[model samples]
Target: MKRIIVAITGASGAVYGIRALELLRKMDDVETHAIVTSSGQRTIAHETDYTPGEVRSLADHHHNPRDIGAAVSSGSFVTTGMLVAPCSVKTLSGIANSYNDELVVRAADVCLKERRRVVLMLRETPLHAGHIELMARATNNGAIIMPPVPAFYTLPRSLDDVVDQTVARALELLDVVMPGIQRWDGTSVVPDDG
Candidate 1:
């Protein structure tokens, strides 16, 4: 079984992580492990209908954010990789700096040290130099810094469509394919009439 770690931090877009869990649950060959920071729980309550328990129920296994001793904290446990959906800037900083003060960061660090793919769906906007530097540092450490930006070429008709497409693309970075996801085929682009 491909074990994938899905972390939900305190970023504004909690649904990204929740949606990722929901989609991953459908895959028979994948086993999902979830970690929700305290702040992430609050964000889910504020932004979505899912309670913390509901979100936890979506995953095959759930780990507490404070459980630094969890199996995922060590490189020996083995995993496909980790996806930090809506990764907060604080989480990004921790991962970039190797500050494994929490389980989420610790697990991500373990994955990076093991040469595994770590995708961070950063949800911040109007970033300054500090945010950019953190992203660069994480990228340098082999983490994929993917900001959850929606693709217009897909012609997303609703907010759900946008979220699905963005999450699908992010998951793709972790080598987890979401079946029937809308992909760019280059046919939507129009020729330059100028």
Candidate 2:
């Protein structure tokens, strides 16, 4: 079984992480391990209808954010990769600086050191130089900083469609192919005549 770690931080878009877990659960060969930070739990409660426990149930295994000794905290855990859905700036700073104070950052650090894919769905806007610098540092350390930006080309009809598409793209970064995600085939663009 391929193991994948999914982390949800204090960022506003808790649904990105939740949706990732839900989609991964349908794949027969994938086993998902989840980490929901305390702030993440609060965010889920405030932004979505599902309780933290309900979100946890979507994954095959769930780890406490404070569990620094968990299996995923080591490079030897041999996960395919990790996805930090809606990664907050705090978590980004921790991972970028290699500060493994908690399970989420520790697991992400492990993945980076193991040369495994680590996709962070940063959920912030109005980027300042500091945010950009953090993203650069994490990128230098082999982390893919992916913000949850929706694509308009998909002609999404609902908020669910937008979230699913963004989550699907994040999963794709980890090489997890989500079926039926809309793709840009270039056929929709019209050539300029002017």
Candidate 3:
């Protein structure tokens, strides 16, 4: 099983993290380790129907945000990758700077130092220079900043479609194959001009 560490932070888009967890649990090859920040718990309660306990049950292993000694908190402990769905700006800043203040931050820091794939599903809507700089720093340090931006071309029929598309892309960043979203391989054929 490929071990993956997933962190859910206090970002406003709580549904993204919840959906990602639900999807990840369905995949047989992944052994998911999850950390839900205190603020993240609040956000989940505020935005989604799931409780933190429910989400915790989905993970193969669940760590407390305060547990600095967790295996995932060290750079030496091996893992397939890490993903922070609905990563808050606060956590993003921590990851970019290598500040291991909390367990989630520490795990992310470990991912950067170990050169493992780290996917950050940044959830904030508005753009700012500081956010951009943090994104650049994380990317430079070998993390993928994946904002949950929807594709209009897909013509999604339900909210689940949008979530699946984003989750599939996030999985792709970790080199995990997901057939949830129909990919764009440029153009498969010429468009019919009837």
Q: What is the C-alpha lDDT of each candidate?
A: 0.93, 0.93, 0.85
lDDT of 1 by residue, 111-131 (tens): 999999999999899999999
Q: Write the per-residue lDDT of candidate 2 for residues 1-194, one digit (tens) a residue.
A: 88999999999999999999999999999999999999999999999999999999999999999999999999888999999998999999999999999999999999999999999999899999999999999999999988888898888889998998899889988888888877766777232221
Which portions of model 3 miss their true places by more than 4 Å? 188-194
Clashing pairs in 2: none
Worst 10 residues of 2 by lDDT: 185-194
List the candidates ranked by lDDT, beginning with the highest.
Answer: 2, 1, 3
Winner on lDDT between 1 and 2 is: 2
Residue 73 of model 1: what lDDT?
Answer: 100
TM-score of structure candidate 2: 0.96
Give the range of the ten consecutive residues with the poorest summed lDDT in model 3: 185-194
**lDDT agreement of model 2 with the native:** 0.93
Off by over 4 Å in 2: 189-194
Error at 123, model 3, angstroms? 1.6
